[model samples]
Target chain A: MVELKVDQDKCLGCGNCVVACPVNGSISPETAGGHGPKTEDVIMMVENGVIKLFNEDKCTRCGTCPLFCPTDAIFLE
Target chain B: MVTNTKEVKGKDICVQRISPEEKRELAYKDDVCIGCGICAKICPTEAIELGEIGAIERTGVDESKISIDEAKCVLCGMCSSACPVDALDLKLDEKSIKDMAEYPQLIKSAEISDDLCIYCKACETACPRDAITIARILPERSKLVTGEIEIDKDTCISCGICEEMCPADAIEMEHHEPTSSDPTVSSDITVNKDKCVYCLICRKSCPVDAIKAVCRSCSYGDYDLNPEDSETTGSSFIDEEACVNCGWCQEICPVDAATVEKAFEGELTIDQDTCEACGACVEICPCNVLSFPEAEFGEQSDKVQADETYCIYCGACENVCPVEAIDVKRTAVKHTPTKSKSWEKQLSELKT
Candidate 1:
């Protein structure tokens, strides 16, 4: 299974993953690096056009988050 | 020496004339720098850290900026694109395309807030450098060691897992702080046991000061002329109550006048203070020449962890061999030399 490890340092929290994710609930935002495996953060991060969030469990292992990612983050394992 | 200041000093804000030699190095920051051709476009000398856009230096900087690895960058921009005169020259390496592949890793500086880390160890499980140490924070008399974050920087890949999962915001991704742009050991870290009393001179001399003062009841050949324990016994005492017939001290004695054995049994003996406590002789002598007697292995200094295996044993190092610390036999059997899956490296890659 392709697991996903988000790069919070670079994650702009742009919500790209939130929108790209096939599952309704995968990925969220936390200013801090991580969050519970489920649930999203209240804010969003967008960096150099790349986006990321603190929500971990929302990911479906689709790899889509990293695929469309401009920054090449989101390792889908 | 540079303190965090809102005031941009030196080359940070001012446009300084750069030398051709300095223009050679640059590390790119994708976001902070807009890559407005102005940096490349305005170079008075046409010097900038250029990125690979199109065949022509087009409208927008394709991606990547031009900063040399932290230590190498002279920060001189005779060719800054920001210059209106267009004198700066932004040069890149032929292998830059490959460098771009290593980008994310260049940017991440692991950051942490003290409150967020729960020692969940999720990140620990993920870290490849074994750089992240989960030391327990001990309050005076708390009798408990709460987790403290220690990094063996040499091995760290700059991954942000600890920063990512830290519920308490304790871990952070910091900018790569180059210990030495031209890394050189401040001094040699070898132990000279003969002329040396166990006074720990080199340990005090280290700038990074990667040394520890370890005290444990090491085994001494019962026959040692100057047994470190002799001081406690007021010269020496043969504990008839506990003396075992296995007189190891006599066989391995370099000076055989005071043999600890009835004959040359060749068991081997040890000297606690002179031992360097490297555990080397114990691992190699085929007989255990030393032991760290339940020695609460002093809270290992971060440098020790940092130095763990960096020694190449190549003798190339003017300093100690990173390999000297490793026991070939123990490792072959244990195979547990602080494993990590490049968590920091991956974080750095994504950051780029």
Candidate 2:
């Protein structure tokens, strides 16, 4: 079955996707994930920079908000 | 099953897939399209050659392949989104130079989305050549995609700074969980891809990764610093007419790019990418130093702190200022290991 992939370099943090997601954490803003034991995570925006430890378990896979990007920066694929 | 994207051989891809539902539902097969009007309009590139794709369009198979023109290309980068089949690519027209990098036996390139991202910009960025340019500009939300602190792979001495200040748990120093004995098999930065919005604050705070970061491709124009003039520089121009010198620019600038250059001159200048809001200069100045004129605070962002007194002009504060808060020509500061790190990395690095 096909699944959604969030391109980290393409996201703009508009919060448009967060607002559009129907499921909680279905579609979150992040990158790279590994098996539970491996602990793969994404770099996030900390105060004025990047935080590189976001959890994948937080994702809901919902494809609502990525559809609203005017720049096509956010996608559900 | 046919893939949602169809590849264009030599042409430029500029058609974005606006419908997330349509992308998720796209079916695919080998030689199925007959250049029929069916998938043509569906194709963002209009790249289908009639007889080229006849397998599935004729009815025998469930999918077909569409032939694409390799020459008439502009690379605005959108066709991958247009394909209802898994043929087109949404990646940049040209691949990364590393697309051809030779991995020594001791240095086998890690398999990134190995199933997909053969172009390893991240590894390049993480490792050496200052080689990483974040190759693929996937159209999802490119604007918010940049890292917060500047990780100048060139100067990144690997001394993770800006890592200490993260209160939101955003940055991290990824210890690549090696898939094998080769520590090089990058676990690097496993971005919770869906969780990050590319705020770029991370890029700025890294203390290590610093880039001028002005997206020249950004047509928004440059930093028309001389707002009094009519020229546009792609940055937020200070509209002298409307700019009441409220210090909004100073505060709004996450990098402290904007500064109250000469409050007496009634003009503030944006330093761009070097300013971190420690509020030292703002607090030291007796002239109600750089601040939002309206002084409005609505949970939008943390209010800047100001304590004019005790703010000795010894320039000591500015010297330690990570964001370069003070005009050195005007004051002084001492050397301190003011560091910032990816909060997420700090936490995870601290985690088991």
Candidate 3:
């Protein structure tokens, strides 16, 4: 298991991580098609202006979200 | 059976379509893609679409700006070739057609030669897109200059004059209040060695001659260090994804290290009859080609001047002018040729 943390200051909310996450892709095709998730049952989604984590159980600890982050806002431990 | 798959690796997103006869792949980069919508506009199959760019940029939210429809896409590579930032890639049978001679390739490019570059950082300042970044390491200041400072405790009356007068804030005085029985005050002064630039301001300001200081670099004719030991060295890099081929770097570079090929060939003209000389176009021009001539004899200039040599022909001036006085005619767009009628139609739209 890994911990996911998004630095609010650094994050630009570009949604690069939302498209990159395998769990998000599995949950809905809208995310895989390069759009934000329409369903709520996902690991993370863009809310208000920044990304917010929802279903932590869906995360496979893939650690791909941090790699795609342009501003280094996401950290997995 | 046909299968479609997707994968994200770092900044790159790759989508693959496989069948019995052929295998095709398309890749997009998050960092390189500026969400300019050029690919979406040029897509022959209408497979690419753009999201709300203005809302996403203003809010700084996690929202995708570009999306592709796999079913509608034919993997023709039109969108990949039309992208200004080179953010898209299409491959066939494990080989990129862009590398092949049969396909037309965009001749536009930007390059910087390391051997010829002196690291002057002129290009970094001139780039309108902020695409160039230079990192330089200069000689250490302490090695070049040597200094010493001292303060006498007995002579220092704790008047706090030197501490107040210090420009570098290097001096500090700690004061102890006198007891009722004993009416004498006691204090200690300290000079931070690292913070002190040895300007001798505190020493000169001392009323009781309490401070002594010396700077050796001012008097010494020559130091023992070699000239080569203090040489400046560093690297400079241009962000290919961010560069717009504006030719500003090439124009400002003194060493001829930077080279650029522009994306458009065009002419811009201002109608004298309609122009009010509000200087709207001058403020909007990103390439700094347009400017209002200086007023003479305390009279405001009635017209704006333009230097066409640096103009990238981006049509920003035409869009910004409120009076409809400016006309920008794009004679040609620098892109790979295409046989598709839709691509030709899209290319025609850019010329006007």
Output the number of the DockQ-best candidate: 2
Tens-digit lDDT track of model 2 for B1-352: 3223434323222232324333321222322211223233323345544321111221122223334443333232223222212233333224311122221000111112323333323333322112123344333332333333334445544444533434434445554545656544233332243334444445566665543233332343335223334221221223222222223333433344444322111122324234333233343232243443344556443224433321222222233232333442322111112132332222122111
In candidate 2, what are the lDDT values of residues A1-77, reduced to their tens digit? 11234555555544443333322221221211111212233212221221222443433322233344455554323
Which portions of model 1 show Cα errors greater than 4 Å?
A1-66, A69-77, B1-38, B45-76, B79-137, B141-352
Regions of model 2 farther than 4 Å from truth: A1-3, A25-55, A58-60, B1-352
> Ignoring the other chain, what TM-score does chain B have in each prediction?
0.15, 0.15, 0.64
Clashing residue pairs found in predicted model 3: A13-B61, A13-B62, A15-B62
Q: Which candidate, 1 or 3, has the higher TM-score?
A: 3
DockQ for candidate 1, C-alpha atoms: 0.01
Task: Kindly list the per-residue Cα lDDT of model 1 for residues A1-77, writing each as its tens digit.
Answer: 22456676666555554444433221232212233223434222444555544445543232334544565455543
How does residue B248 of candidate 1 score in lDDT?
36
Shares of reference contacts reproduced by the candidates, in order, are 0.00, 0.00, 0.00
lDDT of each: 0.30, 0.31, 0.72
Model 3 chain B lowest lDDT segment of ten: B52-61
Query: How big is the RMSD of model 1?
Result: 32.8
Question: Which parts of model 3 have CA positions greater than 4 angstroms off?
Answer: A1-77, B1-73, B91-103, B112-122, B172-195, B221-232, B254-257, B263-265, B272-310, B314-352
DockQ of each: 0.01, 0.02, 0.01
